[model samples]
Target: MAQAYDPYTNVIHTMTKAMEIGHIDQSMFEILKNPQRETKVYLPIEMDDGSVRVFEGYRVQHSNIRGPFKGGIRYHQTCDLNEVKALATWMTLKCAVADIPYGGAKGGIQVDPGTLSERELRRLTRRYTFAIAPIIGADTDIPAPDVNTNPQTMAWVLDTYSQLKGHPCPGVVTGKPVELGGSRGRNSATGRGVVISAKLLLALEGKTLEGTTVAIQGMGNVGANAARIFYHRKAKVIAISDVSGGLYCEEGLDIDAISLYLNQGGKLLKDYGAPGVTHITNEEVLTCKCDVLVPAALENQITEANAGKLQCGCIVEAANGPTTEGADDVLEKRGITLIPDIFANSGGVIVSYFEWVQNIQELTWERDQVNEMLEKLMSKSFQELLNVTEECHCNFRMAAYIVALRKLVFAEKMKGIFP
Candidate 1:
């Protein structure tokens, strides 16, 4: 029988492989594998019907050796401690790969946010914030928006934290509304970063986005933004999907129209109708023939079962842990170049860092400036990955992991244990 997928185990396996391939010191491996702290809080909120419901929430601080813990808060029904731990670990690697001065932490509430009213959700957010307040702050740890969470969620978190601290504390969170000290270009940073990664990868193959065909799985913030950017760059966004399912068009999807439809609150691609658009299952989106297949949805979307069947020449993982370790082996054997999520989706954190800087220094940057700096940093990081790839003679995923693990291990070595 096949074993159930555990994202935490998958990450550890990948890290081990990277360390082995790069000949990194193994003394700190065990330390890197375990989080420094894990907090699980039970949030009891009064629903709209006046019934109290207890929801489980988690906050896993993976590491803070390099700097403060930084990650996102995702509201997902399947969210659990192990999942949060995996995400937090990924954030540590991501920040290291991006060369940012931040560690990794992740928090999530196990609840389907769609079933909650706005008031109920806000109350839940406040309760969770109050529970984790002691460990999180502008200088200690910061949280942002992740799956099923958005700018409004971050705003609520910021408000709750500020009220608790008895002052306005905008830097306590990132991905908040621009009015609340959130950096410009943060909302779409991840998707933009995905596009930039695709462009860079394509450039290596002597191609460009002008006529490239792309299929993106997931139509959330990351995927939707990438679809729009790819469309504007003259790429044929042939397929896209959400939780509702996927839509395909051989002649290229009308991303602008699709985005508009999805933006009008409570929309799903399955109900969408357009000329030459055909509804397909999410699996089809993964195996669709395209130059670039971006699994921007969630973890384990591309596993060994489907990895061998993928038709794309390359994959740019915009979602953290979207591809499993077993699938990675298949893809590598098939010569499918995959740009790891750690570096590809670092845009959000990069801009989050910018937002944090602006909030701490009482300054604001123009949107263009933020975006230009994001591209510059990603480009530079990509070069670093290439260098590591050449040095280790490994695939991009291994190369990225090597780059991150080396930095993390070095930080641990320098910051040795203290009493």
Candidate 2:
């Protein structure tokens, strides 16, 4: 049985397994299991239709033992405390794996952003910011972009928080417009990190990105950016999907043209047509013929139903919780290497950390410099994860969790429980 997909449960189950395998002290399990705090707010937005609607929102701070809390804010209709908690916990594990000086937290609002006009969306974002204002700051919890949110969203958050502070407070958020103190590489950091992780995994087997076949699900920021980068790196992206639909090309689609077509706005995969491209279902994108499959979409996309049917040699999770526990077992038994999301998608947070540093210091870094630093950090973390995987004699996901749990539990031990 696949077991029902509850992201929080899946995270805890994996964390507990990693803790047991890594020989971590069980006494600190409670702290890691429970979020430090969960904040829920009702955002009342005055709709453009001269009506008022209240949306539910949440911010889950999973841990701050390593440093201050940090994570992304997602505006999704399905956003809930459990999902946000899982995401926040992954943020903690991700930072620990990357050895970044930050903890984990996630914020989200339960609203279909597509239903709102731009003016309404802006108003909703600002109101959400105001509701969560007291607990967030430069030195406190910082939010970045996530699903259905972007640099413009962060700009709204930054502007709102700065208004409350009576000064420019760029550090209050990340992934803002570059003109508003956002890092140069922040936009594509997650996808870039995913590609970098894939390259590292391939290097261990004497493989390279050149000519590697890849199929990616969810052509959002993460998936689209990863597909473009992989295409530029000489890898053939055979399949790509978005909320609208999917497209496949046996001879490899023209990524540059597709990206350009979509970048113009008001376009979707169903609307994107060209030579050598064929329309396919999103599910088909997951099980397509390819050497690498990147699931950059929402959680539980790779459940047991399709886990056994995956045809890829490796899966670099560009989205959080893309693979479930049951799917992990399925892939492991199939001899497929699954690069966990925390390790694979740490780039955005890494750049987010850089953005925070730049904001606090009032300095900006060049694009090349940011990209170079991101690759270095990702490479170092990949090496550590490989070491842990070998030592634990387990899967990559468990090994990554082990590395993170060890660091988190050690920090908790050294600090001890508060009085």
Candidate 3:
């Protein structure tokens, strides 16, 4: 049997390795290793069936030294406090690496949204929001959407918080609908950022986006949009998958058609029949022959069990902690260029920062402006991470951790301990 996965342990492992490699101060390591605050709440919601179900939720503020705590709120059955803690810590590192003026925080409710109707989901979200409202705010901590949540979910959060304050407080949340003050490019920012990172990494090897074979695991917002963007960029999206299964074609799958099918609420790739499209299992999609493999599905998708089987030339983590430490060792031994999640999939938060700015300033920028700003931030950070990797003789993941940890620790030292 495979070893039990602990997301928080993976995070601390990476942090300790990066600190040792960077030769940072031990005291700083002690301070930067844990979240500043973690709150758990019980929300009792009245379901449409007239039954009362109490749900467990959490909000972890990893750090706020740079600015307000910034991260997304995920709703999934598997969302536990440890996972939230790890994600919150990653948010902090992601912001620092992206050079965004925000700290790191994460919130989640332990419930399978698929099991709840739209009405129940909304009620649960609202109740959970009210429960954690005291700790979250525009200038204190801002929550966006993550995993199973979307713009609509964010709207619910914004509305719930606003209702409590008895005023229109749009800044209380980001990733909301456009009419509600969401940034123009916020929807596809994470996917766009994934493609941007891939392009940057390829350019370093005298390559271009065109003619590259890519396989993305996960068909949600991040994975689907990433597949579409890469398809538009002339890359051969050989394989793609959802929770059900995957589809593959050596010559490249019709990304446009596949996207349309998925957008229509299609579930499994087995039902997505198209000419030349071959049915492939999720495992096959992960280990498929491709130039780039994007695991955007969930944490621990790529583990020691199959890490050595990954055939892609490069692995860009679109999901949080998709690859385990042991798996990372295998990839390093295999010389597969792996881009860390903190930097690779930060486009969403980067744009979320823009949305927060717009909400605070009560001003909205054009899509072109948002997209342009996003590219600059992602590309610049990519280059810096590349430099750190080369300078420290470490993998991209370690390099990113070193960069983020250094910034966070420096801030921690300057801030010092309160009396």
Candidate 4:
């Protein structure tokens, strides 16, 4: 049997390795292991079918030394406190890696959104917002969208929070509709960042994103947007998947048609069919022969059990905690480069910082402006991570942790213990 995946443990394993490799941080070791705060709430919403349901929800703030608590609210059936804690920790590290003025936080409710009707979903989101309202704010803790939550969900959050505050508090949420002060390029920021990470890593070997055979393992906001962007950039997306299953094509699939089909109600790739396209299991998608393999799905997709089976030149994580610690060793031994999640998927939070800045100042930026700023920041951070990787003689994941831990520990040390 496969080992159970615990995101918190996974993060700690990487941090411990980084601490040993970096070899200068023992004072704050205990401080780095635990979250600063973990808030849980019971949300009761009236269902459309005349029933009331209560969902368990959580918001974990991992750190706030750098700035306010910043992260997304993910709604998945498997969402729990531990998962949120791990994601919150990554948010802290991700912001430090991106050099953003924000700490780490993540909120989520344990419920399958697909089973909720539109009205029920809206009520549940609003109630959850009300439940967590006391702990979240524009300058204290800003909530954004994540898996199963999107601009619409953020809109509800913003509206609910604003209603409570008795004013338009756009800064309280990051991924709301653009008309309501959302960032212009926030929708594709994470996906674009994944592609950017792949491009950056490939460039080290004198290669470009064009003509790269890519296989992505999720088709949600991040994976679908990534596939679209990669396709537009002339990358051959040989395989892609959603929660249902995966699809593959050796000569490169017609991304445009597949996207349109999925967007038009063919929600799962298991039902998506076309000429020359072959249906494959999600496992096949992960281990497919490709230049780049993107595990954009949920956590623990790549574990020691299948780590040696990955056939890609490199792996770019679009999701949080996609690769396990044991898998890290396996991939390293196999000579496959894996871009750490903290650095690879930091784009969402980076642009989210931009959105928060704009909302606070009542200003907006053009798409090109946001996109350019995002690329510059992610690339600069990537360069720094690469430098640390070389200097420490460590893998990308550990190097990223060392870089982030240095910043976090230094801040904590300077701030000193609070009374």
- For TM-score, candidate 1 versus 4, the one ahead is 1
Predicted candidate 1 versus true structure: per-residue lDDT over 1-419, tens digit per residue? 99999999999999999999999999998999999999999999999898999999999999998899999999999999999999999999999999999999999999999999999999999999999999999999999999999999999999999999999999999999999888889999999999999999999979999989999999999999999999999999999999999999999999999889988999999999998999999999999899999999999999999998899989999999999999999999999999999999999999999999999899999999999999999999999999998999999999999999999999989988776
Q: What is the C-alpha lDDT profile of model 3 across 256-333, one tens digit per residue?
A: 888777777635677889888888899999999899999999999888889888899999999989999998998899
Ranked by lDDT, the better of candidates 1 and 3 is 1
Question: Which candidate has the top score in lDDT?
Answer: 1
Q: Rate the local accuracy (lDDT) of all candidates.
A: 0.96, 0.93, 0.92, 0.92
lDDT of 4 by residue, 73-103 (tens): 9999999899999999999999999988899
Pick by lDDT: 2 or 3, better one: 2
**Clashing residue pairs in candidate 4 (N, C-alpha, C atoms within 3 angstroms):** none
- Model 2 ranges off by over 4 Å: 1-3
144-252: candidate 2 lDDT, tens digit per residue: 9999999999999999999888999889999999998999999999999999999999999999999999999998899999999999999999999999899999999
TM for candidate 3 is: 0.98
Assess every candidate by TM-score: 0.99, 0.99, 0.98, 0.99
Model 2 whole-model lDDT (C-alpha atoms): 0.93
lDDT of 3 at 402: 90
